[model samples]
Target: MADTLQAGDAAPDFKLPRDGEGFLTLADFKGKKLVLYFYPKDDTSGCTAEAIAFNGLTGDFAAAGTAIVGASPDPVKKHDKFRQKYELSFPLLADESKQMLEAYGVWVEKSMYGRKYMGVERTTFLIGADGRVARTWRKVKVPGHAEEVLAAARQL
Candidate 1:
């Protein structure tokens, strides 16, 4: 695994498929704050709740000059369905190759029922317009996480 990124490190750049069509790149968020969240799967209970919470504060985030994006190993088709079902107002990135997830150090070993597996660490990064990470939340809990991220983005 790559070194875990910390605040003040240059945010890694990436371009990945997004829901609907076309792609989203780190450059797309240049000159603006970005809330990039990595979750384990699409449409799962925790992931869905996190997406909805972020979606619920879309206007506030926009007002703060921030953009919210959720990424997972799921493909574009799955992302589309998830977005539609939740009425998400932001982009859901498809990181099927796990490149972005690894680059950001959110891909790691996880254990459940005493069995180990590789999966996303449910992390969130607040990146400033200058491309530096302003804050990071690892092992994120879904409850009030979007609001927490929004508060950090406002600081950026």
Candidate 2:
């Protein structure tokens, strides 16, 4: 397990494959505020809603000079499908090895139906232009979460 990052700490750097074309590195986002979100899976109900809500607010995020990036343990193919299905404007990173998820402290043991399994926990990190965590939402509730992230991005 990786150490949990706290607000005001430097966001961890990662390089992961995007849904299309090529890979994206944290360095590429320098000089811009970033909304880095981690979700459990692709095309699931809550995940779908969260992605769509973010997609719906892409313009607002752009107006604030912020970029959004979603990450999951799913493969690049899955990300491609999810992006295409939702018309998401941002890149969905493929973290097949779960390294990035663990680094972000979003990968953990989760319980459902009396069974526990390791998975990505819903979380979001608002990274400032300076590359530090400006805000963080852990165990996030998907409903209205994108709007809350937008508000934080605006403040950044």
Candidate 3:
């Protein structure tokens, strides 16, 4: 397993395909606060709810000088469907190789009903304008998560 990232650590760089087309990188969010969240899959119950919560707060996040981006191992096509289905206001990154997920320490071994496998850990990283992680929420529960993240980002 990879060492978990913490506040003050430098956020990892990634060049990933996004929902519509083109790519986004960590540098794209430089000099701005960012909510970089990693989820298990697109269109899943928890993931959809989380995305909607964030989407609902998009204007608020922007007012706080923060940008929100979501990442998952699902492909760009899936991301497109998911984003359209929810009318998500932010970009959803595709990490099909799981490389970015591992670098962020979100890809991990999970067990459900005694079936063990690798998947995203439902994590969120609040990165400051300096590119250092300001806060990290691991094993995140969906309920009120976006509001919590917005509060934290506002503090930053």
| Model 3 residue 37 lDDT score | 95
Clashes per model (N, Cα, C within 3 A): 0, 0, 0
Which stretches of model 1 miss by more than 4 angstroms? none
Per-residue C-alpha lDDT of model 2 across residues 11-68, encoded as one tens digit per residue: 9899999999699998999999999999999999999999999999999999999999
Candidate 2 deviation (Cα RMSD): 1.1
Q: List the residue pairs that clash in candidate 2.
A: none
lDDT of each: 0.92, 0.92, 0.93
lDDT of 1 by residue, 19-110 (tens): 99999999999999999999999988998889889999999999999989999999999999999998898998999999999999988998
TM-score of each: 0.97, 0.97, 0.97
Deviation in angstroms for 138 in model 1? 0.3
Model 3 Cα displacement at 18 (Å)? 0.6
Off by over 4 Å in 3: none
